[model samples]
Target: MTQLPGSYESYWMESVAGADHRALAAGLEVDVAVVGGGIAGICTAWELTRAGHSVAVLEADRIAAGVTGYTTAKLSSQHGLIYAQLLKSLGAEGARLYARSQQQAVEYVAEVSVQLGIDCELERVPAYAYAESSDQVEQIQAEAEAAREAGLPASFVTETGLPYPIAGAVRIEDQAQFHPRKYLLALASDMVGRGGHIYERTRVVSLDEGKPCRLTTEGGATVTARDVVVATHYPVFDRAMLFSRLEPSRELVIAASIPGEHDPQGMYITQEQNTRSVRTAPYGTGQRLLIVTGEKFKPGIGDVSRRYEELAAWTRDRFPGASITHRWAAQDNTTTDRLPYVGRFHPGAKHVYVATGFGAWGMSNGVMSGRLITAHITGQELPWSKLYDPTRLHPLREAPSLLKLQASVAKHFVGDRLPASHADSIEDIAPGTGAVVRVEGRRCAVYRDEDGDVQAVSARCTHLGCIVHFNDAERAWECPCHGSRFATDGTVVQGPANRPLEPRRLPTGTEDSDR
Candidate 1:
């Protein structure tokens, strides 16, 4: 497998200059406190500000640094073979509402981008879910029919502008794509201009629910608000055992400069067991960047590096002369029934809300969440509210999947603790890589930095005590149970984990004295 020159950075982040927002310094009060700076949070703040409410957005890091910054940015309602399944599980009416919500979200984003004069490279494009095999072709046809029934502009066709031929495909017209970060930064600026506050590097550690809720930040700052929106990619608080109900998954993305002037007219995704997504964006003068993404798996469950290798190999075979320019990965939560949770956090809970479980199609769902959540908070009714209500439960539909997800979590939680480490000392760790090692009879995560300095931290995740495994592709420690990721130095990257991994003191005289 061929390796790239630098560490992973998303093409979107590399191209756009990010917005600057200060962290919360002292206590403050607002009408609504949005606890994440990703798409959902920014959109929620924008909507609330327009509705004449004082809003504050608190981000653990800079804006758009979460899933939004790492997305494929396909703004479409064609989410694999989902419409057909939704018809069976949620019935015709429910499925129609789902399609309507997504379509509205697509229009909302395009309208806002134009209204703000944001140069996000927004374009109207068709999205295709194609099949390369006979069985999947039948599924694609069914999905097209179902999508049309649910009021989507979908049609079944055997021909697409793909590099290779597909057996069949469900093509949705008038869908779109854009530079997500650029659009989001514009919204952040608009919100701030309208008296909405945004604070970066300000992590909301905990929430106290009340008529006027209290949110405590990591730096001993408190934000009192009439309502709160937990838009963090994964809900930090498990008020309803959300950790068990949602299954976390990860996928890899790679951007390469095509050798020639070859470009696909539309975005395409395969419906095979191992899914692959393809799209392109303007790179420079008459040049385009081709993004190919796939290799989905549970975080920490497999060899992360092998997936990157497979992606590179696949790209080499298909786009023969393409060379990798950028590589990155994203993680998302999948609900038992596959619909996003987008309303109040739980039944009978009025002030606190959560928007999560976007699966892999977060671009549309994230925007839909903002609209739905803001409507609920301001005492307005949206047609799709009941459909996406976080408190709604379908015991019959959810029981089996819920049980399977929890079983997997239980297996990992107990099984990881009983395993013996292969390395007895820190010296076994390779430079620029990390692994679990036994130190003084304790399981410790050890990494040797590029400078040959050894760092060690507790192997257990701070979120739920699940053992974390090293992900070599991104060089981060990942929790298998709930998808919390940490840097080699133990800083939290993505979470349900609000705290960093516990640092360990090396035994006396054991450290390399090169320092």
Candidate 2:
């Protein structure tokens, strides 16, 4: 057996011992019900609780253990080369609003940490968007100018504190990085301390929006709230078909221990080589965790194991002598308009709201979404929320991306169902791995453990009826259409899909074989 490098868990998750909150036991009523215990949901709940509203947080899993825990945790507005694109699409004022919102989000973490006395390892540092190849220098320069115009403290420079030479870079000052799980776990504690209720393993199965939004849990418990915020990373409900406008991509992260002297000294990213983001966190005495992330791809569409290898190779080349200590992946949704949806769920929604599509900048965007949603619920909406209104559509800017996204989704929805796309026999599935196979004229997601036990589940995604593909590296079946992920036993791991993939019986004729 080939051994994988490092611990197969997030460093952020490993570094902290999070609090354990019980699952929802019975029906309850609160001023607000927040679905999801991630940074966004937790932040929103904390804000609402501080605003004198009774709030209950319902989490399908542990708090801060999802995308927020797996994040790179760079709290900066310096999304690689985003200002240039935003300038063209949303104009100068709109871009400034985004910059200001994100910048404020960075400080919000710092301010809140002090206010709550949470030791979250928050450190202010510069952030950079660099160009490696000569051909991309002009783009970096343009981004610098655009970012400056957008009211950020951005400037173009040739030298970044990187190990390698770069053609040019756009540097933004006053950015920060921290242990997101530490910060969010503290926020979760504060929420509970402030009389806000939190429930774990309480997956919201359905939402009925009205004067008092009614949310039903998988455990048969119910939560009634005057308002509800669906900050479940991806909104569980698609009443407005927001799923159609969102594109899901998964990126790999590898962290290694390096000498403190080798620290990058800043958060850095580039558009080259799929994408490369670099930062460091305090690891141990006189050592720092050199975290590198990149190799973005749509979930369930690529060889994820190979992508991890590529990321490792790239990291080793850039930072020699570094010993890899951890490896994990994060899934993010990008909106058609390249901004998050963080406001009223839809135009018609009176008491329901959603916050999603933070792209890869979840730490900053998640905080911003929380604050924005809090403002909306309290009836003091920020002007910047207009940029993220779920109902606001830019037909001219969004049509092309939206159409392309749906086209790919449509292909997977229809094409993966063909018999030719599935394994001909169970023998095609290797031990300790899985594959989609057609058995007894029915499509099934089958996994064969190293112990030789086989299990099968319906291959159709519970979210939109698209076929689910096995992610060998992560050991989860993932929906390519909308990023719904399921465990080997067919239980939901991530969502847009609240229901588990139904278990299926293997036919008598088809059996596992050694071929």
- Whole-model lDDT values for every prediction: 0.88, 0.91
lDDT (10s digit) by residue, model 2, range 1-515: 24557899999999898888999989999999999999999999999999999999999999899888899999999998899999999899999999999999998899999999989899999999998999998899999999999999999999978899999999999999999998988888888889999999899999998778899999999899999999999889989799999999999999999999999899999989999999999988999999999999998875789889999999999999989999999999999988999998988999998999998999999899889999998989697978889999999999999999999999998888766946777877878899888877888999998877788999999998999998888899999999999999999999999999999998674554563
lDDT of 2 at 30: 100
lDDT, candidate 1, 1-515, per-residue tens? 35664447999988888867788999999999999989889898999998999999999999898989999998988888899999999899999999999999999999988788998888899999999887777788899999999999999999988777789999999999899998999999999999999999999898999879999999999999999999998999878678888999998998888733587789899847477998888778777788888999898865888898888788778777777889999889999999999988987678999999999999999899999998998889999999988888899999999999999999889988775774656777767788888788888988888887889899999998999989877888999999999998899999999999999988875558434
Please count the clashing residue pairs in each candidate, in the order shown. Answer: 0, 0
How many clashes in candidate 2? 0
TM-score for each predicted model, relative to the true structure = 0.97, 0.98
Number of the predicted model whose lDDT against the real structure is largest = 2
Clashing pairs in 1: none
Measured by TM-score, the strongest candidate is: 2
Runs of candidate 2 exceeding 4 Å displacement: 509-515
lDDT of 2 at 260: 97
